[model samples]
Target: MVEKKFTIESSQGLHARPASVLVNHVTNFEGDVMVHYNGQSINLKSIMGIMGLAISQGAEIKVTAEGEKEEEIMESLEDVLKEQELVKN
Candidate 1:
């Protein structure tokens, strides 16, 4: 498993658009990805699960990937987060 922690930077937090971007990106990978926030963990591929978290700006989140191409998935996710301007610099 590969895990990384990030602080959200978006003013609107992990709202629908960003959540969908994340879910859509990870869906292409053949691995398991999960997001942990506020002591709860949810599948990163599930838009509803992410939305249910109601993550706000500056919230700390931990993402974990396991199985095939876990490391690559982590790197890709980091890239996506950065590209989306969702994480602090």
Candidate 2:
């Protein structure tokens, strides 16, 4: 299992565009990937699940992955977050 925390830094927060990008990115991985925020956890590959959270700027979120490629998945997710400018430096 691998886990990492990040603070949302995008002015628009984790809105539709970034949320779609995130979901699309994780869908390629084999295993379970989840995002936790505001005491709730949801599958990272579900666009509705992520957007439903209404995660705004400054919200701290925890991402976790478990399975054979957990580490790689986490690294990929971190890169996506940074590339999208959705996480703080």
Candidate 3:
């Protein structure tokens, strides 16, 4: 398993757009990916689960992935998150 933390930088936080992006991104991986927030962890690939988190600006989240190509998925996720300006530097 691989885990990494990220600070949300989007002014709107993890709203529809960002959440959708995250959901779509996670779907590409063949691993189990979860997002931890507010002491709860949810399936990152589930749009409902992610949107339910209601992540706000500056909120911190930890993403963990286990199973096939976990490392590559994490790295790609990092890149996509950065490109979306959703993950703080």
Candidate 4:
């Protein structure tokens, strides 16, 4: 598995739209992916699971992925989230 810790920069954090975006991204892959927030972990491919976390701005989250191609997926997901949040590389 690969993991990355990042802060949610969006004012609304991972809400409906962002959550759906994240879920869609993860679902596009063949491996398993999850996002950990506030000590709770949720499947990255499931919007409902992510929404349950109710993340907010400044919240720290750990993104992880496992299975074949997990390393690539985890790195890409981290980059995507940073892009979505307008974070610098």
Candidate 5:
């Protein structure tokens, strides 16, 4: 498993578009992925799960991946955060 902590960069936080990008990235990975905010954790691939997370600006999220493609998924997840997510890790 791999984990990376990233701080939210977008003032509006994830909202809709950025969350979709995150969800889409998670869905593409075959391994298990979980995104943790504060002390709660949710499935990264679920749209509702992500929206329910309601991440806010300056919030810290822990991106984790486990299973066969853990490393790849971790990298992919990081890329999404850096490129699409309103945050940096």
Candidate 6:
């Protein structure tokens, strides 16, 4: 498993658009992906789960991946998150 802690960069937090971008990235991997926020962890590929977090700007989140290609997936996710200005890990 691989995990990276990120501080949410978007002022609006993990809203719809950004959540979709995250979900999209997660779906590309065949491994288990999760986002840890606050004290809870949820499936990264689930839009509803992500939105339910209601993460705010500057909130710290941990993106984790396990199983095959976990490292690559996590790296790609980090890139996209940075590109989207969503989270700085």
Count clashes in each candidate, considering only residues at least 3 apart in sequence or on different chains.
Answer: 0, 0, 0, 0, 0, 0
Per-residue accuracy of model 1 over 1-89 as CA lDDT, tens digit each: 99999999999998899889999999999989999999999999999999999999999999999987999999999999988889855
Per-model CA lDDT versus the true structure: 0.94, 0.94, 0.90, 0.80, 0.83, 0.89
Candidate 4 structure, TM-score to reference:
0.88
* Residue-level lDDT tens digits of model 5 in 14-52: 788988888877787687899888678888888898888
| Candidate 4 lDDT over residue span 1-89, tens digit each | 88878878788777787677777777889977988887888888888888899888888888888899998898778777776772336
Which parts of model 5 are misplaced by more than 4 Å? none
lDDT of 2 by residue, 1-89 (tens): 99999999998999999899999999999999999999999999899999999999999999999989999999989999999999855
RMSD of each: 0.7, 0.8, 1.0, 1.5, 1.4, 1.2
Candidate 1 residue 75 C-alpha distance from true site, Å: 0.3
Model 5: which ten-residue window has the lowest total lDDT? 80-89
**All candidates: TM-score:** 0.96, 0.97, 0.94, 0.88, 0.90, 0.94
- How far off is residue 75 in model 2, in Å? 0.4
Comparing 2 and 6 on TM-score, the stronger one: 2
Clashing pairs in 3: none
> Which regions of candidate 1 are displaced past 4 Å?
none
lDDT leaderboard ranking: 1, 2, 3, 6, 5, 4
Superpose all Cα atoms of candidate 4 onto the true structure and report the RMSD in Å to 1 decimal. Answer: 1.5
List clashing residue pairs in candidate 2. Answer: none
Tens-digit per-residue lDDT, 1-89, candidate 3: 99999999888998898779878888987979999999999999999999889999999999999987999999989998988889755
Name the regions of candidate 3 deviating beyond 4 angstroms.
none
